[model samples]
Target: MTQMTRALMTAIGATLDLGCDAIPSPGPGEVLIRVAVCGVCHSDVHIVDGDWGAPPMMPLIPGHEVVGEVIGLGAGVTAPAIGTTVGVAWNGGACGHCRACLEGEETICAQSEGTGYSRPGGYADHIVARAAFVVVLPRDIDAARFAPVLCAGVTTYRGLKRAALKPGAHVAIIGCGGLGQMAVQYCRAMGFRPIAVDLDPGKLELATRLGAVATVQADETDVPQKLRDIAGEAGLRAAVVVAPAPSAFTQAIAAISPGGAVIFIALPAKTRDYLPISISDMANHEKRLIGSNVGTRVDLLEAVELALTAGILADIETLPLQNANEALDRLRQGRVPGRLVLTMA
Candidate 1:
């Protein structure tokens, strides 16, 4: 393999510039991967626009949904052998000795490194990743299809898992965008009835094909009522708000049944981050509000397995690696109806 690699790099408030870098050998407990494909997430656009603030490093290669083949291994790494296909998500690595890590909750570990943020990521032909954090992937499926599973798939899966809803429970997936589409499939695969809510009728129609039992055209003021009507007497068991709009949160918080939970999975811009809630209502209804970061290594594995076994897949459109900037532009402008993946091959 060549010792140099091509990548799309950008600093905060700058555009992505195609550049080259010497592919560094993996350090201990790390692996060098030849990237097969990388999913362009909305977060990547946010990073480039400085919406999430300056990244820990400048000229960042922003991508968390990465799928690739292991080409080299550092010392003390043996399980994911050379040539094995693997996937890397946003939670790059965590300090094993932290209290959260000991409880198998590495996603919340204080010392966790975020892929594409705290560390160099997969927006390149080659990437170096912590071996312990890469999830081994099946070779049979098209690798490009699995890229978004590393982020959009696992993020929604983990968020819904945290709700602890029973089988046949009714869960409302607010926003029928990329992440919301994936969440709809997962809800069905996990044995729950999903109610898809979106302002776009086209997205709602696609969500219906993906397994949402019900679809609601989101009217800002009527969303909660529509969900309540669809959920019937049992009520909306839980609501996973994947839209980064405050109005979405307000609707979700009001739609869920008493004692149900609201799982927040989207990160909005700093300017619109605050949400005013009724404290008394929450206390009286016993509604739970929880924040879910990306999932741990274990959760990623389960999410992949469920996706493969249950025929859950992201609705995606592929673009060449060099068109990354175009992909980000589409996402930023809401022109993409589903996830966009950039293929290196």
Candidate 2:
């Protein structure tokens, strides 16, 4: 058994605590990772504000966009050789016996485990992850640059996949922030012409540069009508809401064309923030409302390949682990441009 000294930053009752601890070796089917960088996701901000019901276990190491080196492997693990660069995401593990898992929809499995939320994750020196769940990354990509791809990238990709839009179809993406930016890039790479919607002009401009053919200012009173005018009477084939606002859901529903799928990948700070969905409207228009979690392990692998092959990457900022609290603060304050990451040096 290998025990190594590690310095970790933990979430303690809405505050961050930096401390030194010893990390244990991996157990069977697990791989020990020497973390190089971990991305700061908006979900981490919500957890800090106690938005997800009861507080998580004290001293929770919160981070899901993890990139690291496979330092040690437990029994029966092969491939992803020791020292391989790999990534872990929001999903940690799932019960393969469940119907959802058996059907390859493990992201929605009843016994699904989340990295930062359900268990200890990145934001530390090392993490022991399920070998089957870790994604092997290209050694050439910088760890900090690709960290967010493990979470934000895969999430939006899966969200778009759920829509199952035809190639080259027009798809509207609401919210042009971290996740939304990735959504725009993925939309283009997947062959969909993306219409970006956001209240922030700067973000909209960024989205346009990233491949969005159209941009809508969300603050406009006639968001739905404006969307229709831009998308035309034929309507959109799909819409993805990456903005963590209930209003974004309502806007997506109203703007969707007939038979369009509205995929939601973001959770608002509170359930109360969710908008009312009229049952009649859904049946009349046949608009599909879809909920997409982070995505399955296979999706994560494909997303990594997409990033490496298509050059779809998020804008990221790197900071030391000690600045974890400051990074969370910036995310909550909406100051971060794309993604903020904590480097474990």
Candidate 3:
């Protein structure tokens, strides 16, 4: 291995530049990984555009859905063998002494380090990660295809779990983009009939191929009524809103049946849009509105296992590391059908 590595970095907001750099060695309790592939996520766009606070550090390498092989292990790290394939996700490491960590809710650790945001992420040939936060990928799964599962897959999986859908439940997934596509597949695997909602017919068709029982065009007249009709007597047992649009959240609430739950999984730039539900309305209907972030380590491991067993793979367009900016633009404009993955190999 070379003593130095070249990495594509965002030196300033909205600009990606390449430079040669010395590879960082693993610190105590850390593991050095040779990055194979990294998926471009919406959060990466937020970082590049300075949407989520300021850039954590200058010359940031923005990528969280990372899949790689362990090349070196730091002192006191013992579990992951060198050369074993593993995945590094957004939650880099958490303070295990925090109450959240002690309760097994480490995803909300008060002092958690976010991958790519708080630390150097996987947009380079080699990246260092804490061994405790890395997930070992299954041998049968391809590394590239498994990358997005670290973020998008786990986010949707945890959102659905929080919704608490039972078998044969009616579920609606808004926005047939990257996250929505995965939600459709997961809903099917979990024994729910998935209704995919989107403004684009092309994405709806893709969702159907991914096992959606029905698709509703968001721009259609009376779209909420249409969804309610399709859901029939059972109505929507739960609706997972993967789209960041505020209107989608309002419509999702309207589409649910009595005693149903609405889970918002995406974070929008604008936070002012409100879903107005009277206190009496919520109490009488037993409706719930909640937000879910990414999943925990156990959730991520289960998602990876499900991906390996069910052949659940993200529909991705592979791009070179240099085209990361272009990919981000496409994603921001909603021009990309699914997740875009950057290859550093």
Candidate 4:
């Protein structure tokens, strides 16, 4: 067995610690990947900082947006032959027989396992992932550029799909950070006009460069009015809130068209998770607040296809794997405008 270097979270609210360990062989229905790059997600910061519950295990390796090459396959696995490039996402694995799985909605599987959470993740030099869960990626693209697509890309794509909007409709991408920027590009690729909302002018500018039709500053008064004005008579068909702020949710629910949906993907800290919504307005207006988890395997496939054909890619900054702690710090500080990817090479 080859020794692999990994970053480990010893406890909640602790900076990750670097360590060396032997790479384990894949078991049945698994594949061993030589990890090339892994995106540093804000959720990693949330997990490390205990914004969510305790990690399923201590000394957790926090990464899910992983891209790598398959170097070995477990027994009974042969399709994704050795040397194939693959990407692992937030969805690590799920029970095959659950009702959600049968309904082709494995993202909602009650017994779903999360990468970098319930199992060993991609913050290491190597990873062993469930064979059925890894998406085979194009060998042409730089692995670093594809890392965030495994999470942020699929996430926002699925969110938009849930909106059920028509082409030329307006969609608000709240936050305008890494995920929000991707949301903007996806909206354009999916044929909907994207309206970017954020407090940071820099991010809003970047969103425009990435194809946002309009930009709104979140801190301005009458933000909903501004959104309505920009969206015109059609109004915003949906708002994808990728920001972890409860205020963003409040604003999104208020800004979208009366019958429009507000898709929630961000997970704030447990203490700040509660939101007060008017049940009467929701009922009368038929507004919907929908929760989109990471995404299904099919959603990932579509996202990858859109990225390849429509030229949608993340704005990424790369760092050496040893600098994992620094990457997490930047994400935690909200200092990164786009995704930060940690490279093992």
Residue 137, model 1: Cα distance from true site in angstroms: 0.7
Per-residue lDDT of 77-131 in model 4, one digit per residue for the tens?
A: 9869999989999999999898999998999999899999998899999999999
- Candidate 3 residues 1-345, lDDT tens each? 565343445554556665657889899999999988889899888788777667767677778999988999999999699988899998898899989999988888888888888889887778999999999986556777779889999888888888887799888899989899988888887788999999899999999999999989889998778888998987889889988878888888888888888989877885554656678867889998867778788888888778777878999989877677788888878898988998874
Model 4, residue 344: what's the lDDT? Answer: 94
| lDDT by residue (tens digit), candidate 2, 1-345 | 344323333444356777666786788889989988999999887776677864445556778999999988999988579989889999899998898998999998988888877777798878989998999887777888788888999999998888888887788899888998999999988999899999899999999999999999888888888777777766787889888788888888988888899998888766556589989889998999888888998888888888888898778889998888889889878998889988987
Off by over 4 Å in 3: 3-12, 271-274
lDDT of each: 0.89, 0.84, 0.84, 0.91
- Model 2: CA > 4 A from native: 1-12, 55-57
Measured over all alpha carbons after superposition, the RMSD of each candidate to the real structure, in angstroms, is: 1.2, 2.0, 1.6, 1.0
Q: Could you say which candidate leads in TM-score?
A: 4
Error of 4 at 153 (Å): 0.6
Strongest candidate by lDDT: 4
Model 4 bad stretches (over 4 Å):
none
Q: Could you give candidate 1's per-residue lDDT for residues 272-339 as a string of tens digits?
A: 99999999889999999988887998889989999999988788999988888889889888999999
lDDT of 2: 0.84
Winner by TM-score between candidate 3 and candidate 1: 1
What does the lDDT read for residue 59 in candidate 3?
73
Candidate 1 has an lDDT of 0.89
Decoy 1 TM-score against native: 0.97
